[model samples]
Target: MGSPNEMVYIVDDDSTVCDALSSLLRANGKNVRLFSSGAEFLSFERGDVGACLILDLRMPGMDGLEVQKLVSNQASIPVIFVTGQGNVPSTVRAMKGGAVDFLTKPIDEAVLLAAVEHALEKDRIARCEALQQADLLARYHLLTPREREVLPLLVSGLLNKQAAWELGITEYTVQIHRGNIMRKMKADSFARLVKLAGKLKS
Candidate 1:
């Protein structure tokens, strides 16, 4: 599903840095939200917005890394860490914890813009995949027990006759179940059904 708006959330205790980054992002045609602390950022309603977090790693309470972990559990919003200290261990830790980019202080406008764009695109793609998965689950819920049993074999590339034999059912019955599965899934072709089955497997 597509979000109603795209926002770039800036979480930095430094008011000057927050204002500057907000101005720069707004000038570059992005919607921006500024939070003075990690706590403020965390408290916002998150799922409806298409956004990435620009977080300063050295905040006083609820530091950036902690915030990243919190957001990681809440949603798949991409994060770009901004740090004045630029310690290697912290950078590595942030990266390992799924921060999309680690940026240093005195941020380069071009690099920052590029990072924001990349994070937003990544979030968009992830949200789309999540939506697809939800749709797949809903379709799967509509399947009958027999259809569910036949689906795995069909997806294993078994022919109707083979699947029928394997399941100890008549070929006509297998065909009927297969037709029901295809209709329920809204899958127009066997290849599409296989793809859906692969998603379920994963």
Candidate 2:
């Protein structure tokens, strides 16, 4: 079972399979949502909260691979394929297309649960990193042009005097710019400033 904020999306044309999987997941205190087709699943708007998709490989119209293609741009939501007609080529294709796991039907309950847990945890981690990156970029954007100029030099291990010389400004002016950078970035110390700068560069 995952946190209340997490969700598991099941997309399969088979009513029996959808009902069974939904029952199993909800029995274990998980939040489950079901769709009868890949097109319906794709049309649904999902929240940014942690979520993963369990999709069937074969369907009437849009299949698992096609849905994977449509949703590939959404890097945060991972997918796991549950298919009765699994083959070597399809498994390879699913993995290559960035599915988190592939399970043949007559799906093992324990294995399916484990894969769901793993995918949800992965989504949590990716979302956390994305938030941190956005915060770093926002802080970086707050810097004055001169403060921005001073940041890379400080990260590169340049002394205030050397940075001042390079920018053709007084050392005192460089110190002011450095102070402003630190305050605006909310960096507690020199090491923290360096770390934020490294994140921006990466």
lDDT of 1 by residue, 1-202 (tens): 2234888999999999999999998888898889999999989886587898999999997999999999888878899999889898999999999999999989999999999999999988998988999999999999988899999999988999999999999999999999999999999998998988899877
Question: 1-202 in candidate 2: lDDT tens per residue?
Answer: 5687899999999999999999998988889999999889888988766888999999998999999988887555889999998999999999999899999999999999999988888888888999999988998999998899999998899999999999999999999999999999999999999998888978
Error of 2 at 110 (Å): 0.4
The parts of candidate 1 lying over 4 Å away from their true place are: 1-4
The TM-scores of all predictions, comma-separated, are 0.93, 0.93
lDDT of 2: 0.91
Best candidate, lDDT: 1
Q: After aligning candidate 2 to the native by TM-score, how far in Å is the CA of 79 from where it should be?
A: 0.6
